[model samples]
Target: MTLNQMFDFTPVYIYIVAAVQLFIGFSLSFAIGQILPLRIREFMYYLFSFLFLFIPFLYEIATANVQSGMRSFLFYLALLITIFLFTKESFLKKLSLFFILIFFDGILEIVICSLYWKGICEKLFGLHYTPYINVPNQKVSTILIFFLPVALAEIAFNFLFPLLWKRYIRFIHLTTFVEMILLPVLCTNGFLIFLPELFGMTGWILLFFILFVLSLLFLHAVTQIPVI
Candidate 1:
């Protein structure tokens, strides 16, 4: 499939919804961080992280729906809370990095999966493969598309996050910076969920423009963070 067709299949707003859920989880963690004593927060962080890791399993046990999208989303939300509690960085830096990491993961997943599908289609069926035609090993391709990008993104984050933290990120207060990231994600998510038909190409274009501006602002903000 062409890139445009691939883009058409995966709406931009799905990522926005995921981002909103992630931010909500982060906000909840932040609120908990405020209310709890340090010792309690530390203890709960470990405890909750361990339990959150089993969210998908718990979901499967409760609903018997192994392929439910809600299960995956809940797992990711749990992961965000786990990271928020575990990271030693200032809250603002943690929020910034979490946003970037989520964005990076979504981009990686789409690009890798789309390319893999295209390559396999072309290899087995020549250049004229259509989505309607059943391809061999379809189940294997589906599994790879679902799991490989996530695994790769996790590995990349584990390897690179510490380096980025040490070399680049400085502890800073920037509530506006975090708000800028959160607002667009939340708004897009709401629009797509409630008023999807009205949110078309124009809305998508506007969202991309907003994201580009935010990215530039983030880069500038990074430069202004004072070194401790």
Candidate 2:
């Protein structure tokens, strides 16, 4: 049997999705660590976020249906509430930051996937390797097109986020920051779930363009953050 037949790589997306959530979790911990005056050990922050994000997806993977829906949102919300309670920030600030973190995680992925998806898909197609069971509506080469670049973009963005944050992320009011980030999360997530067909090819190009504009505006809003 060929390597593709030897190893099943289809469920790999579960791991990839988990990995992205972990990255988001870590980024949230780091961001919260920076903003809050709590004296949390850096390791604990990562550990908490890891458990919070990992467990649900792990369960989904085991069950053979890894979906992002109302259930997923509720799981995340519960975890966010738990994490926020661990912080020293005021109640309202904690709530705002919770949404901000969620928004950041969601939008960051959208931006990366939007920008590099085609390049990643093309590169994979060039390899001409096919897994045994193919994904519906997609070729084997393209099955991971979204995940691979999102993974790369996640790493790059995570690195640049901290650096640029220090330089470019001036503290606007907490409420404003939350509001700005929230728009993209709602629109992107809602559109994706309800009208995913609108996100195909040309739609993705337009969606990405719109998201790019929003990201710029969000970054500009970041510059307005008041020193908290």
lDDT agreement with native, every candidate? 0.48, 0.57
Writing each residue's lDDT as its tens digit, candidate 2 over 1-228 gives 543443264354454555565564555556666665664676776566666766666654564344544335535654565467556867877767666655666777766655554454446555443331244224333545545556666656654554555566536466667747755665655433422343457766765676677677677776766544
TM-score of each: 0.44, 0.60
RMSD of 1: 10.8
Candidate 1 lDDT over residue span 1-228, tens digit each: 643244353333233323333333443344333332343456577567556756645554455343344555565567667766565666765566555444444445456646755775446545433321123223334444444444454445444544554455424344544544554443322322222224667756765676677677656656665641
For model 1 the TM-score comes to 0.44
Model 2 CA deviation exceeding 4 Å by range: 1-12, 119-145, 190-228
Task: Using lDDT, give the best candidate's number.
Answer: 2
Off by over 4 Å in 1: 1-50, 60-69, 121-146, 164-228
